[model samples]
Target: MSEPAAEAAAPAADNKKKKWLMIGLIGGGVLLIVLSVVLAVVLSHGKSKKGQSKAHDTEQQAEEGDAEGGGEEHADAEEHGKKEEGHEKPKAEHGSAEPEHTTETHKPAEGGKPGDEAALKAEADQLKQDIAKLQHEMDQQTEMLTLSDEAAKLKSEINALKEKKASLEGDKQKLAEGVKQIRSGEKKCAISGNPDKRLDELRACLGMSQHGESKPGEHKPAGDSHEVHWSYNGENGPEFWAKLKPEWKVCAEGRTQSPINLVGKFGSGVPALSYEYKSSALTVVNNGHTIQANVAEGGGVVLDGKRYKLLQFHFHTPSEEQINGRANDMVAHLVHKSEDGKLLVIGVLLNRGKDNPVLKPVFDNMPGKASEEKAVPNAGFDANRLLPASRNYFHYDGSLTTPPCSEGVKWFVLKNVGNISPKQYDAYTQLYPYNARPVQAVNGRAIVEN
Candidate 1:
């Protein structure tokens, strides 16, 4: 019994020992696998922590960059606002609000989660692009404004140039018209061939006479009552006299007119003049042109054996005739007419000297109103006292000094000038300041000294 029992116990003990060993080995492998799994989980958690730390750093860097860029952009916008304040106030206001918008955008980035960093970065990039676009648009608008200002200045300059060119054209036209008038006068004088006869024909063509009536078959009807009105200044002055009537064209177009300069060599075969005067009734009249005194029609002068009766006499200030390129203070023209309707004028130049009793009656009783005639009763005036001591004279064939400036009149200007008181000269000048016409061109006309 002892042997059998010992063998069975030994086998069962061995089996139990083997089973426990296997269980122990299996438990050891399970423990190793659990430890490995715990280590892997710890490593993964550490790597995740490291990655989150890196992403946080990058987000912080991006936020700082965005803040710096926004600050710089806001500063630039503020500066631009100040620069554009004058011309564009609306743009200035828009630029001034940029700093506020940048501040609001940066507020969200300070408390943002690490997970939202990429979205914040993407938004910042888009905002930067928008800012860049706005800047580019503002720059373009500024350039456009500058160009517009320059264009306005150029337009103003162009307008000024146009105005100056127009003024120059007007002046050129006036000069051309004046030249044409001068050429026409010269042509007419050349075609006539006779200077003295041409003057008469011009006067006849102009329909001008001393009595203010048109000649027959020249212009308006002989019975026409239309009177040509003129004045010393204003629209009806000498500058516009030619345009007043068709017959008075020669006043502006005549080449050989009166009141010429007595310069150059004298001509030969000059006729002498002899004056025979007598006392006559003095009738003064203000004929709207000058103070004229009418004689009794008996006074006469002998010129080349032709007797011409003195009809009237008138005075002029700053004498119409220039003697030796100089003018006297005043002059007296004694008008005379021959039987054949020919005219002759004796000009007596007067200067400031002793008071002349010969002209006292004409000045003291002068008429006041235009076209008014007044006869001084018992006012005896002798024509001889009006002449100088010397009878030497310069003669020329010219036209009347007044419009219509009739021509073909024989003029005798005394070489020895007479004398008149300052009071007498002033009496005539008070009424008409400048009644004499501008001196006409000589046009190669002959002047004689006798």
Candidate 2:
């Protein structure tokens, strides 16, 4: 039993096993076919995945390469820009490849972008150059201003110095003039005392008394009247005055001329006549022609030890004293009275030059207008030089020489004459070139010459 059963069982089992194997095989085949299909799909999928991975890798690599290339391109562009900017030349960059865009934001290098940094540097350089130029201009302006101020200061200083020098020069000239005037005064004082010595001293001190030594040749009388008309430099001019004035007859008759040519005339052998003078009270009178200084009662004149009372002194132009018929420039008539009331006149001649010490006081005291009177204060006028040195004289009985000529005047004219300067002559001539009367016939008078 066992064998048959075992054999059947075994065969059934083998058949079952075979069937199971076939099922398994079929399943395995199906699984294999599915597996094969799945494998194929998987393989395909795997292959596709591998291909996608490879594609992804390739894409990543290409992205990396693009990134690297973009970086290099950017560097090249920057380099080209720098080169162009250095030369101040314009350049353009065009990217045909698509740009590698990045989300990350960045700033420019230090100051700005490449071009911007270049522009900023240029602007900084321009600012520096502008500042330097402006500073230089400001320095030039400051220097110019300083120079102008210095020039103005120097000019002002120079002007001030010039003014000071001018003032000092003026003062110096004034002082010199004052000293010269003092010297002239001393000389005049030394000459005033003695008649004989004074005459020679005066001749030595003064120049020629007359423009011409003698009066010009007399011309026939045209007419005579109070309103007589005369030409300045024609016939009957100032030169021939002796022919025109009766009171001026002594002009031709006198031995010595007034305004005497005194220089070199004095000699060591000549002795001066002695005389003295003192201050006296003075009264003043105004006439139509000039003012007169009247000697007061206390005043006296002593001549040769003869005492006389001084009356008055009057002025005249073209003085009565004459040298070879030449009249003096000006004269003063000093009237004196003897103890017996006899009248005596002393004549003093005057000429012009630098101001005369003796004449300045008299002229200063003179009344300006005709008929205007003024009293002299501290009267101190010298009368020693008033008379002619030569006592020898022409004696005649005549009238007053002025207007309303009175008769019965005892005229004693000394032969010697006095001197004056040419300026004084011009001054007197300016006042009255011809103020005297025509010469008269001597009327049987005794004429004398020294």
lDDT of 1: 0.66
Write the residue-wise lDDT of candidate 1 on 70-106 in tens digits: 5532322322111111344322221112221111111
Q: Which regions of candidate 1 are displaced past 4 Å? A: 1-225
TM-score of each: 0.51, 0.35
Pairs clashing in candidate 1?
none
lDDT of candidate 2 at residue 127, scale 0 to 100:
100
| Highest lDDT against the true fold, candidate | 1
Off by over 4 Å in 2: 1-277, 301-307, 321-323, 339-341, 351-355, 385-396, 412-433
RMSD of each: 24.7, 34.9
Instruction: Give the TM-score (vs. native) of candidate 2.
Output: 0.35
Clashes of 2: 17
| Candidate 1 lDDT for residue 112 | 58
Task: Compose the digit string of candidate 2's lDDT tens values, residues 198-265.
Answer: 54444344321121121111111111112122322334444554465675555455432232222222
